[model samples]
Target: MTNTDVGITDDEGSTMTLGEGRTPLIPSTHDENLYYKHEGLNPSGSFKDRGTALTVSKALEEGIEKLHVCSSGNAALSLAVYTRRAGLECVCHVPEQTSESKKQLMEALGATLVEYDGVYEDIFHELREKDLDGWNVTPGVSNTSLEAYERIAAEILAQVVPEQVIVPCGNGTNLAGIWRGFEKHGESPAMVGVQMKGAAPIKKALEEEKSHAVVEDPGESLAEGIIASESFNCAEATDAITASDGRLEVITETELEAGLRELVREGILPEPTSAAVKPVADRYDGVTVAVVTGSGLKNYTELRELC
Candidate 1:
């Protein structure tokens, strides 16, 4: 299939575009059978671009003037760039304690940053009660986000057919979408979702065979992208993992550090969150493809320390 044939079409001829999707799938220098999906090369330097590209287009299609999201970082950055490109307004609701630099980056990307107090999830929940005018750009809350990530699987399939697809899973929306996409094409690859140890509620839930689990007082993690009190689409994500015969793997800080160094040495600088997949990918035989979720340049503060 052509790139257009596999990617999400600008259904109504929406103009919002950043050349999102069509990321290269390159074979890993470290492992002959392993390939890395260079998602960090996207305009916003993360996989969120695949989803944001579509979400912002939908907003334009509906004549929506504003959008809002609750994000710690990448999602907001993605939304900010896409929404700005689409001539729309985006407001990011971030934790009050979020770093000034992070908040400033969102603003720099053209998003209006709003600070929220109390539990991160609870604050968003309360905002939901407002019945806001714009779309909730949270990964799971947006149907477009889930549908958007399906395009990644399509892009990956067009490049190579691996025996397994590994994701550096955060809220699991991306993982759920990959399962949906592969299933749509009648391909069954063992999906592997990797997470940082402390904030791994999805891993815990899978072990318990439950719909979901909440991480109480999640420990400090090097992978800030995946930290969460509870994943927004836990049930859907859990169902996807179970149905695909996939299991969750948790990574500790030490392994995460090694993985970060390995990827960088191999000439790919990935954010710590994306590097969490290294150990998991190493364990699998056959053709395995791991999604490199974001750029280490954006997380230079932590990346510098880790290196």
Candidate 2:
């Protein structure tokens, strides 16, 4: 199917038009049977582009003049880009500790940045109280967001059928989206969700074989993109993982750093969050695909400091 065929469009026949999907599935140099779905190559430099593209399109179709989202980074950037392109006002509520690079990029794209004093959950609560004039494009909270990520699974199945699929988990939207997409296509690959050790609510739930998720305190990690105290769509994610007989993996800071370095050395420069899937993929025996969710450019300042 064509790229446009995988996306939602407005009644006026308009979409984000930034070429969001159809990322390359490149075989890994470490293991030929292992492949990397390079979602970092998306127009806005992250997999969040897929969801934002569709979400913004719906906003335009509904005649919503403004859009808002509470994000750590990637989602905000993606939303800012698409909303700006579609001539809608975008407001991004971000944590005070959000990356400078991401905050700058959001503002550069003309999004009004609102720095929240607390974590993302706090922002979510605040947003819920305020009557925003437009749609809220929060990842799991927004219906259109996860549906857009289904295209990733469709694209992956079209390219190659892997024994397993691994991806970094924040609010678990991507994990749920991929699993649902595979189900739609009558394919069920073992889905693995990876998260940083300290803030791994979904991982803990998966290990206990629990159908529900427990909220925990998020900790510090280089993989800032996947750190979350509570996933907005944890129930859906748990259901998907359980249905697919899937599991969750937690990576340490050291492991994530090493993985990022290895990917960059292999000419695949992904954000630290995206690199978290590598160690898990390395342990899998059969053909495996690791979804690298964002570009290293998103963390250029921090990466440069590391180098």
Candidate 3:
């Protein structure tokens, strides 16, 4: 099925078109039953395209001429592309450490990129203070964006009934959205959320059984996409994991690098963040599907250096 079949249409009955969904589910060579959901194949080269498409369409329908977002990289790029497609102005506030490649792509897409001196949460708070008169397209911050991610779970179930769904967690919206999607089908597959070892808010919250995420300094990691001190949808994501009998896992930078190399050996190029889920798959015995969230091309310079 196509993205239009799963995406939201506005009150005026106009749906965004980007061919953002229905990514390939290829069986992993490492295991006969294990599969990889290649979300990197999206038009914008990341899973964020799904949510951005819907948000931009809704903005168009409402005549919202400008859209604002705070992102690490992929979300900003996705927003820039969709907003440009919808003839709306896009502004992005990104962390200072955001990759140059991502920043260039966002600017190339005609988005105004504002580099911030702090983390994503800090940028988010600053943007709130500014009270930008536009639709905020940040994934977890905006409820509409979550709807786009639910389609990933639905598409997975349509392809195969896996025992577990593994995903890289940042703001936790994607994990929560996948659970919501499975709920629609009355299926509760085990949801596995992966994060970098030093910067894992969701994992810490799950381990501590906290109602809310326990804020901590997310140390550095190559998997910058999944590094978040606070996840906007942490509570919902924790609830989804608990409901599905799911668990959170953390992988070190070395493990992430190894996972990336493994993917390359298997002829699947993926961003380092996307490979974070690989270490957990071996721990599961049944059919498992790991969601590879973005393309390595976005981090081509870094990945090339690592190789």
TM-score of each: 0.92, 0.93, 0.94
Give the poorly placed runs of model 3, Cα more than 4 Å off.
1-14
Off by over 4 Å in 1: 1-14, 96-101, 117-119
For model 3 the TM-score comes to 0.94
Name the regions of candidate 2 deviating beyond 4 angstroms.
Answer: 1-14, 207-212
For model 3, what is the error of residue 232's alpha carbon versus the real structure, in angstroms, after optimal superposition?
Answer: 1.0
Candidate with the greatest TM-score versus the true structure: 3
Give lDDT: candidate 2, residue 159.
71
Give the TM-score ranking, best first.
Answer: 3, 2, 1
Weakest 10 consecutive residues of candidate 3 by summed lDDT: 5-14
For residue 150, model 3's alpha carbon misses the true position, in angstroms, by 1.3
Global Cα RMSD, each model: 2.3, 2.8, 2.8
Cα lDDT tens digits for candidate 2, 34-90: 999999999888988888887887787788899889998899998889888899999
| Candidate 3, 35-104: lDDT as tens digits | 9999999989999888888788888788899999999999999898888887889998899899899999
TM-score (C-alpha) between model 1 and the true structure: 0.92
Task: Write the residue-wise lDDT of candidate 1 on 103-132 in tens digits.
Answer: 777888788888877556665577777788
Number of the top-ranking candidate, with lDDT as the measure: 3
Worst 10 residues of 2 by lDDT: 5-14
- TM-score winner, 1 or 2: 2
